[model samples]
Every structure is written in C-alpha cells, then in structure tokens.
Target: MQALLHKIIEQPELHAYWLNTLSMMENVGAKKIKKCEHPIFVNEVILKHASEEARHAFYLKKQIQKIRKDACPTYEWQYLLAPKSSYAYLNQLDIDVCRYLKSKHELKHERLKYAAYLLVTYAIEVRADELYPIYQDVLRAYKSPVSVRNIIAEEQNHLEEMEKQLKAFSSEWEEMCRVVREIESKLHSVWIENLHQELGLS
Candidate 1:
C-alpha cells in the first residue's frame, strides 16, 4: 500500500484524480445539505455531517495544493456525475433511497427519512473506516503527510453517530436497512474497483 501510494503521488494525473474525487464528495454533501429538511434535531445532525464533509474537502484541496503549488485541482461536474463514477454511485444512492421512501408514502414520516439517511451514512462511514486505515498505514510507512488523520477521526465520529441514530428505527426499518446495505455493498465494490483502475492498480 505504501508503494502504491508513492507511485500514485508521483503521478500528477493520479494524484489529481484522487483530489478531484474528494472534491466531488464534498459537493455531494453540499447538495445533501440543501435537500435536508427533516425536523430540527435530525436536520442539525445532517447539517453537521455536511459541514464536516465540506471541511474534509478543503483539507484535501490543501493537500493537493501541496503537490501542485501553483494551482489547486478541481473536479468537473460532468465527470463526477458520470454514470459509472463512484461519486455518482454514492450520490445517486441517496437520491434513490429518498425516492423509495416517497414511493412507500413514508417520506413525510417523522423518522423514515432520518432512518434512511442514517443507513446510507452508515454505509459510507463504514467504507471510510476501511479505507482510511489503509491510507494512514501507507502514510506512516512512507513518512508522507498525515493530514488524513483528522478526516479519519471525524469519519469514526460520523459512524458512531449514525449507529446511535440507527438504533432508534432499526426494528421498524430492518428490511429497508438490509436492502440498502446490500445495495451499498455492491456499489462500494464497484467504487473501489474504479479507484483501483484510476490509480492504475488494476
């Protein structure tokens, strides 16, 4: 993993791809923040999550600037929203969940959207939990900047918060949560593959 990170960091295109991907994720969070209109407490949690995501994006941008001192990287909206793009998969999954809830006439239910959000957030946090440790290990092994440490810590906090919120509706939303988890599992596999291919690892 350390070797791979070194290779990627040495390649400008690969590095930019990763930085842009992180930027796209922040854009998704911004979109979610705009769409969130749950009750006060839930809305507060959602906003906080979105704000942290935006902050993570800023951190990633700073990291990119460290590599390309003259210019900061930016992600094209079209590329990020492409059908097979990992960003698209993650963002669209949330949209799909919302639609599914609305179709079941549960959209307006007090806890339904909150439950769906928690499930999706949990899946994302889990993915981060798995990936960030590899990044940290690689950075430590390579003596690279460990700026990602704070993001990893925040991701853990997000995971814990999501899990705590999930407990409230787990019984009633068991089947939906299971279904979302299965879908996320598949999407996440594709996302990981996309990242590998982008990094020329596969």
Candidate 2:
C-alpha cells in the first residue's frame, strides 16, 4: 500500500481517481448503514456514523480538485481504479461476517444484522485507521497538497466506538473480530493486488 501510494501520488489523474474511488467506497459504507437502519429504533451513534462517513466521502471527492479539476467526473466504474475488487472488498466481507455470525450465534433478523454491522464496521474502521495514516505519510513525504488527516481522526474515533460497542454486544467479541479480520485480510489483499496490477506494479 505504501509503495502504491508513492507511485499513485506522482500522477495527478490517477491520484484524483484514487481519491474518488475512496469517496465511492465511503459512500457505499454510509449507504449500508442506512439500509440496515431499524424502522423504529434508529440510534444516535448510527446516525452520527452514517453522517461522518458521508462527509468523508464528500471530503475525499472534494480533494480531487486539488489534484486536477474534473479528473474523475463521476463515481462510475470506468472512472475508478480496480473497480471490481474495490467494490467487492466490503461486500464480500459483509457476506462472510454475516454468515459467520448466523452460524456461530444463531442470530436472526435484527440481532444478526446488528452483530454483522458491528463486526464489519470494526474491521473496516481498523483498516481505515491504518490506511489513512500511511496514505497521509505518503502525501507528506511527496509534499502533496492532499491530506486525509481529518478522515484519520474520525476513523480513530470510529474504531474506539466500535470497540466499545462490540464489547457491550458480546462476551465473545474478540473471537468474532478475529474471524472477521481473517475474511477482511483476504479481501484486502485481492483489492491491493488489483490496484497493483492496474498500476502495472504487480
């Protein structure tokens, strides 16, 4: 990822597209939260999480202007780098986590959904915390104008919130996290390999 970051930031168009891709992925996350919202029991944390994620998406999209105006005009597949694996990364993780939760806990309906959300969001937040920092380091080293510091701060808080929620949700929360991370690690590798191939670095 660090190497990819180093190479990607040198090209304005690719960098802009990368930021747009990140924005699209963030928007997808926020969309999932809304889709999973309870009809009558939506909570404050859920609302805050969704809103912050949407803002992160918007913030990233706005950053593209610094690289080049109109670089990636839309969040279409053709405008994104490694579109297939990028989209699959989160989708596949959610499926796998839900399956794991259902089988292990015999969770159904809302219980199943909330458990999966907690695990999936925790895994993704962990990644965001790690990824944004490395990307920020790359940006600074290259003296690039783009910055993800704001996103990084929010992701840190998100991770902490997810951790506390997970503990309150299950006594076996650590075990659940271990399984989800395994699933996420494989998906992330595929995502990164796809990007490397697109960048001709694989």
Candidate 3:
C-alpha cells in the first residue's frame, strides 16, 4: 500500500489530486471535532482541527486557482471554487461516537498497527501540509506562479498545529499500531475481494 501511495505520488497531477482529496478529508475531520462534547481536552483538539481544516481548504483552493488563473487570466476565483462531493462524505463521517466505535473495532484485532497506521497517516498529512513550497516550485518549474502565498503560509501553520495536537493523542500509540496492522490486512483482503467480485474477476 505504501508502494502504491509512492506510485501515486510520482505523478504530479495525481499527487496534487490526492492531496486535494486529503485536504477535503481533513476538512471533514475538523467538522467532526466541532461536534464533540467530551472534555476540555477534546474541545481543544476540535478547535485546532477546525482551524487546520480551514487552512487545508484554503491551500487546496489556491493550488487550483493558480492553475486556473494561469490558463485563464480572466478567471474569477469563485469559478475555481466549484463544489466537491467529498465534502458530503466528510459530513457523513462526522467524527462522532459511531465513527469512533468503527475505528475502534477496525483496530480491535491488531491495536499497535492501527496506532502506527494513524501516526503514519498524520505524518503524511503534516508532510503534505509542508509541501506547499514544493507545489510552488512545481508551478514555477512550469513558469506559472499564480498561487497566493498567504494560503500556503496558513497551511504551514496548520501543519505545525496539527502535529502538536496529534502528539498529544499518542499515548495509545503502541496499542493502536498493533491493532491497525491486523485490521488493515483484513480490510485489504476484503477490499480486494470486493473489487474482484464487482469486476467478475473471481
């Protein structure tokens, strides 16, 4: 799976799309945090998440805008902000008790690996957050620097803040990693089976 992710990353446009999708996912994650009533600790996490997510959206939008503006100098930013369906899915997940239960069960079988997977995921998100300048360098390589720097700045802030927040939740890291590995293996097999079934490959 990591190899697959690396393959996806090698294609610049696909890499951009993958980050865009992840930003959308983080946007949903922020929304999930907002609805929590657990404790002060949870509230702090939620607040930080909301802030990070808004920045993620801003960064992704700016990336798209840079391309659109370069291609069409007269393009309105609003035109570039077209609605995306992933937001609906994010809203549906809502980081609630049900989702927590699902994640818990997903890890119950092999806790430590689950923790490791999540940590890796968080690390990837942070790295993605820091890759704005890299994206700018990309645009520059293409001789197009239409992206707003401010958006990237905010994303940097989000990366730092989110990393700090994620660290606070690391107490159960070992347990989660153990579970995550087992769960992911099961999920991988199931997912492959389902795809095969749908494609009549079985």
Which candidate leads in lDDT? Answer: 2
lDDT of each: 0.67, 0.91, 0.45
Per-candidate TM equals 0.79, 0.98, 0.42
Best by TM-score: 2
Regions more than 4 Å wrong, model 2: none
Q: What is model 2's C-alpha RMSD?
A: 0.8
Q: How would you encode candidate 3's per-residue C-alpha lDDT over 1-202 as one tens digit per residue?
A: 3433343344454445444554555555554444442444344544655676667665654564443433222223222112233343334222232344355645433333233324433443444454556655554555554353555676566556545644565665445444433443453355435433433445
Q: What digit string (tens of lDDT, one per residue) describes model 1 on residues 173-196?
A: 566666777777777767766666
**Candidates, ranked, TM-score:** 2, 1, 3
Clashes in predicted model 2: 0
* Cα error, candidate 2, residue 202 (Å): 1.1
Q: Supply the TM-score for candidate 3.
A: 0.42
